[model samples]
Target: MITFGFITIHPNQENTYITEIARHSDSNTIVYRFIPTAIDPATEKVHGEKFNHESGVWETAVFDIPMYLYDRCFYGDDPLSIRSQPIMNWLKNRPYSTFIGLGLPNKWEIYNVLRSDEELAAYTPKTIKASSVPKIINKLIKDKKLLLKPKNGSQGKGIIGLMVTKGKVEALTHKNQKLITKSFLSKSEFSKWLDQLLSSRDYMCQQLLPLQDVDNHPFDIRILLQKNENGEWIEQGRGIRRGLKDHLISNINAGAEVLKYDDWVNALPVQQQALLTDGITTIINKVPKLLEREFLNLFELGIDIGFGIDGGVWILDINSKPGRKVILHSKEGKADELYKAPLQYSAYLEKQSLVKGVD
Candidate 1:
């Protein structure tokens, strides 16, 4: 019997997708416990939400530490908060309890690691931590355009695109519910804006690439990769996320629409399509192994790749606790594969635990 414990920020047992994972997990020996990050250590149990498979409704239930804990907690800016910190510490000390996707990694950390690796360096874009206006200006002068994103940002939040021309500096960012475009002709004004943004959060500067369709709608491929029952990395599926015309990043949450993957690739020239698939396959073969060595116990990853008009492919992002927007937007069969992945991977972990006792 393998008991899977899912930990998230909130207890929303009614979430159909959440239940779908548990529902598919129903079996004589398989059980599930949905836990929130706010844990009470004195009780040695957490305030968890468990699905009542028979009743078809989730009810309040106190749960002890299960065989494996899955970290699905979405900590926006601060991955480790006071509330979730204790839970993480406790899990670290628990000998019998194991965790999958233990913690979210920083973007800059990933870039630095990949930058140092010989094989991955060729695939990594030039990325660096933005500390001052001088550094930003230098990148703009060299690259002409720059993209600034928070190191810990997720779902395309806090992304800014800057284009430098002769006498003007135009900045673009998504705010509230719409895209905002601001122009700074004065050097003083632009520097002030840069200072404020840098102080607010840690940012990374990357040389912006031209990643848009012929109609100027920015788009990218979101690849959903997961570890299967055999504990091997597999490409579950892929989806195309197209942003509004002129929008910088192709984040599905940021007004991006899902397009059929096959349709998008088919529209491209036959030779370009071949290059696209070959580049993606190269990424899939290399990224997972490097990441597993850098971190540990990762069950899945959502890789965002950008393709330029010149038939160039670049890795845009790597997410440990990846969002399901890509898979959910995929075909019905792909959605089923996404839901089944968690349970399947947990069983694999359970088998590994039996072979080598959890430390």
Candidate 2:
């Protein structure tokens, strides 16, 4: 039998999603289980939990580290990734064991890699490590408006948008389903704010691109791509994320609304829509290939793209283990694909492993 281990960040819950994979899995041929990040390497086992579909509850059990694993763990925060490092090393080092989607990559690492690609570089905005407050001052001077992104942030948290000129700076973020605003009237004031803001974390600075829509709602396109049963990257779906009125961030979990992809596209002017679609289609076709080549062994990507007020399209962010917002709002029956993707890909991995005799 083929053993497929699925690892995630949190512990047992009514994990209906994981259960969906289990329900559809091939019986007698494949045995799969879910494990938490709090694993013990000494025993080479996890307090593996299985979803009891019949009971509709998570059932706990112990499991040995399998030869094949679907690593769905979204590693963030140095301490947790550090804690999981030994286990990661153990699984990756083994000649017989294979892991799909090895682990998440750092945003800084991704930026540096993607920027090296000429095609990709054209759409990516100028980004640099926010190493010092003075350097941030220089970037503000150059771009006039800037965005500060937490290097390891997820779900639109800790993202700060700043609009600057000679005098005042407006800093924006999404908080508690509301827009959080802070103001600084001078470079020294902004610099002082940065000193306190960035003291505890590493951040990347980027030029804030124009995204003012007809109604002035900050909006963007979120396209989620994933590998299929045949190991080909394909667009799962694309949806529009419209921010609350005048808000900076448009993350759905952070209180933004999901808009259907076609509806939003059709609403735009003919010229702008054509321009936006052309650039986005090209990006969707290329980014997955480039990232897989550069990083190697990835199953899915969540690409965030948006257009400037002037009809220029740009990539806003890239996520390895993307959220389900886009899929959730997609056409009828499309949401079914999201749960099936990991399982289908895992089956592919099993076939590949067997063909190579697990070495």
Candidate 3:
């Protein structure tokens, strides 16, 4: 018998999509779930329930297995929601226990992996941390327009763009509103804003890359890569997400919609198509390799790339555990195949157990 534990950030009610995937697996094996339930853990064993779809009931079953370990497998953002600290410790001490997408690489590590100025062209916007405010201000003067962002931000939450010329700076909120040049005109006001933002969390200043859009809505591509049993990276899914029109960020959580990347790429001018594919391929290959070298345990990554207005490609961001919502949307509910990577990998790991048993 094999022991597998499926967990997530939210409860099963909010994550029906993930539950459906687990329910569809082969029935020859016993699957234990650690989701929160009304049953008592001290009296009722945790690993004895079987899901019944007709009544939406999970009933306890009889089973005794020698292997005692859990796989923190999940499809949602909160995979480590229940007793994570204890679960992590248990997996570390037990033999043959492993986790996927546990913790992601930091922002600085990602930037060092896929930043290519020549390939990015106008899309390779200059960026700096709030700690380097002095240096960033100098660059803002030269570039005339700059974007400020939070260090650990996602979904375009905390970003501000500033326009500058001849020591005069104009501020624009996330909505891209034009100011009257009075409240945020001088360097002192800029310093004040920087101080407040920095006091809470670190921030970065970047040159505004003119990202391409569909129907005036800026869009970015998220390429899903996975390593098979042979340990080769294969492109599993690709889709473009159109952000709320004129917004500084293109994250779907912040009012964005998913589209097919091929649809947009095929419509581009012929002369630029080759350059786009080559650039995307180069980043897709090298970025993952760099992360592998730096963060060896990271097996899967979601690389976000977008095109500048002039057809130049730029790496917008890299998410270690990006939600599968967009990928699910791309396949139009035909995602059972792509969603099987974790299960297939689990089977491969089980083979190791079988080989050792035979020996």
Strongest candidate by lDDT = 1
Candidate 2 TM-score versus the reference: 0.90
Candidate 2 minimal-lDDT segment of 10 residues:
27-36
TM-score of each: 0.92, 0.90, 0.76
Give the per-residue lDDT of model 3 (tens digit) for 1-359.
44544543334533454455456556544444554332243543444445554555656654332132223333222434444545444544546445543445456545544454344333344556657667777877787877777666565666777777555676656534222232366688787776766677767767877785656667888888876655467777888888776666677766778887777779888877887888788878777666676665554678888787787788777776666767777756547765556556556667766789999
- C-alpha lDDT values of all predictions: 0.79, 0.77, 0.61
In the range 187-292, model 2's lDDT, one tens digit per residue, is 7787888899889899999988878677778888888888898888888888888887777778887677888888878877999888887888788888888877
Error at 65, model 3, angstroms: 13
Write out the backbone clash pairs for model 3: 8-78, 9-78, 9-79
Ranked by lDDT, the better of candidates 1 and 3 is: 1
**Alpha-carbon shift of residue 290 in model 2 (angstroms):** 1.1
Better of 1 and 2 by TM-score: 1
How many residue pairs clash in all the candidates, one count each? 0, 0, 3
What are the per-residue Cα lDDT tens digits for candidate 1 across 122-221? 6678888898999898778778899998988788888999998777999999965377989998888999999998999999999888899989989989
What RMSD, rounded to one decimal, does every model reach? 2.5, 2.6, 5.3
Candidate 2 off by > 4 Å:
29-38, 52-57, 75-82
